[model samples]
Target: MLPGPADTPPGPRLEAAVAAVAAPDVVFALSRDGQRTVRCGGTAPPPPVPRERLRYELGSASKAFTGLLLAELTRSGRLSGGEPAAALLDPRRRTDREPITLAHLITHTSGLPGLPRDFFRRALPAWHTNPYARYADERVVDAFLAYRQRRRPGTHWHYSNFGVAVLGHALAAATGVSWEELLTRHVLLPLHLDGVAPHPGPAGTDATGHRRDGTTPTPALDAGGFQAAGAVRGTPEDLLAFVEAHVRPSPTPLAAALHAVRRPVLRRGLGHRHVHTMGWFQHPTAYGPLYFHCGATLGQQAFLGFCPGTGTALVAACTRRFRARDTFVATAYGLLAEP
Candidate 1:
């Protein structure tokens, strides 16, 4: 496990690492000791791009929030992690696929595919505009129920966007409320994460995510039914605060829920040694247990991680999809894991 920074302010080393990343714009935040330091850099960036104010699509990092919501629900006894999802979903629409539990979906071991095949069929037609915007909750649930699993549940670790999305629907079905409302009540409201939203409002200026070409505008993807899988966007300050909550427990009433999600659930061999938590991918490094996850939209990319033992968290979001995003993540990990 990486040791906690010894009262050392993140200095040139961190900046140089981010500078080496190939993105049109990048915002990063480090949280420790109840304080956060945010930094931003880019070439000819548009207005409202300050370190604290810049907003980017969190991509799969949003899954952590969904996982937290699941944990919270379990703590409240509203749902059981081990119960069959068929209990929550409508009976008429249930699929022939093997019965899965809420825990299976949260841990990505439900054997579901990353997306329903029909999702691509619907999305490809409007590839440039917004593939996900039209997929409402009902549609997502229908697609999920009709699909077949490629593997047996809990046998192997496979990440599935469809699994998480179905989990969200099940939660909503059990609660009789929209998934957004569930998230707002259980996580966002308690955390006071005002800047986090499923959709970008006209009031705030968002950093435009650039296409892989680095010139074209990235398609505008919406949360729709996959809202739980990906679709949250937030300012750097808001995201940093979210990470801070995981670094240490927040004072919110949902503290138990927050702590519950961080508990390591299973181990996986993903090239690097990794322990999968409810949402976050966890690793034990020489310094400490590293909890991390990365996100990507059609254009934007995001990375977030923290070590509980060290009380250090790294939150980075970038606009402009590029090949070096992985390299940038490795560099950030190297810096954070340093002694």
Candidate 2:
């Protein structure tokens, strides 16, 4: 039987912190001091949100899962993180700027810019529609090959959707399996997380991503070329479950790989300082050292974080595009810190 809220003590303070933010849907789940698992907001009676209906877009947060998959592939000897990314792709199809490694892709230090310069310019008119939806895989690959580099690989950290997309391609080539299948088999299935899916568009119950104005709904994300970067969708409860597994993980290699990804690679700055480890961001918090990640698309906002010290993980998903301002992260940390 599913555990009830009584078995899982609620973090009222965390709930209040989320409430203060006025987020459309907030889900705080904690597993501390044994089998305790408490959920507030999303699943409560007179529910702030319908538990089964709200599907989060996951934004860049999808990188964490992709990172885990890559780590697993490396652990199994199917792929190597140290190898240059160009080695996997056709040389004629790769950019000559510099050697981009899988590690650089995972760490977001590959010197690749965040997004294509014309991505917005070209896609803005259909901004609410899934712009990348119509672009074929060949188009995505061509964009990468045609693009020029702004800096040397591994010299600095700049989040790049294209970099991760390349990693996805490499993983597929190495494993001879599609990225979606790899994620489903290696990550979701092992964790028994049936709620998570590569593309939420076909899932009739998935939540709709509303524009910033909250009046119009955006097209469901196109997973064709963006699956590795930001295409997964799931409910807040499922996300919290995934975090719990990370906190007190099993002794298997998958769990070990997850821990390996959390190791700090680069110093981002004080409380807000960050280390872009495998797929997640490591940051210090009042609750103790925590690994967190937030994602934003044109029409959605999502935050997923877990405090290992307290065995607490909180996930907040909203329909409208919310700014990833300091206040957003601070608010999440505040909820996680409450005892």
Candidate 3:
């Protein structure tokens, strides 16, 4: 079992950082040198266990998990990402552009758009609340089919929820199972991350969200077709545990895969200075390459990252996604990248 967040107290820097976020409730789970602690702040009181277990929507940080699943499947020889993802589609129609491989999907180089076409048709109605939840799985597939590739696959990097969601479907089509089951079997269960649930159940959670006011409640996004993109949700503990596994992966079920994710896979941004690993964005610092990915639901924000060089893992979660969410990201990144 991982060490509990109560084992140690956070440093002054972490405490002040957590307190700065404009949230009614927030938690910062920090692990360093194998010790961990959770700093709670904001107007709301610290949530108890179980309620605290799923209180934050992980948003795009979920891509890290998807990256892990892709690595594990590739490691186990389940589905070689080299195969064209189109083969897994319903009609399996060939496109005029270069064939998009499964690898391209996970790497965000599939030449797919950021969103599926006609997404706004349904999303506009629920723009402020759970937009992706309106795009059902079948409709998502149809959207993929309707889109014509504007850029050549593998030529450039463009983050696309459409690509990853399609990859989830392709994996399911290949394995004859759902992405949820695949994630549970190969990633979550093996890692003991039972709290990172994408769907709701009888056991209600304290994971509700709030708008910018930090008081008005906002509906949680239980993504329908976009589950693979960003539906993962859990407490700061759950996220810290996940990142901790990467920090010291030996003996873990996905140790090799975990190590593989940190290696720079693609380079992007100005002068190719930014690094893209299988799961996280890589930024080199005096400490080392800091790997991280952040996400936000309509009302909540989350940042997850770790630096192997400095041996740090940080998970920042909050109920309100204020306009200054980037400030939260900068603060979290500072915590991880601090030498």
The lDDT values for all models are 0.77, 0.69, 0.80
List candidate 2 stretches off by more than 4 Å.
Answer: 1-11, 33-49, 91-98, 201-203, 251-253, 268-273, 324-329
**Candidate number achieving the greatest lDDT relative to the actual structure:** 3
Q: For model 2, how does the per-residue alpha-carbon lDDT over 116-196 read when each residue is reduced to its tens digit?
A: 666667666665677766555655666766666678877887778877877787677666788899999999988887888
Ten-residue region with minimum lDDT total, candidate 2 = 39-48
lDDT of 1 at 219: 54
lDDT of 1 by residue, 1-339 (tens): 223455556755556655766677877677766666666675535456464586788888889989989999999998888766665787565444557888999899988888877888878876776777667788888876666667777887778888898998898888898778999888888889988877775644677877777668775557678988998888888787788888777676778887887888888776646788889988777667888888888888888888877678788887777675365577657655654
| Candidate 3 residue pairs in clash (backbone atoms < 3 Å) | 55-207, 60-295
Model 1: which residue pairs collide? 1-285, 1-286, 1-287, 1-288, 2-287, 2-288, 3-287
lDDT digits (tens) for residues 180-287 of candidate 3:
899989999999986677665444574678887788888867688988888888767777889999988886999989988888879887899978988789888877
Residue 246: error of model 1 in Å?
1.2
Q: Which stretches of model 1 miss by more than 4 angstroms?
A: 1-8, 49-51, 92-98, 270-272
Better candidate by TM-score, 1 or 2: 1
Q: Name the candidate, 2 or 3, with the larger TM-score value.
A: 3
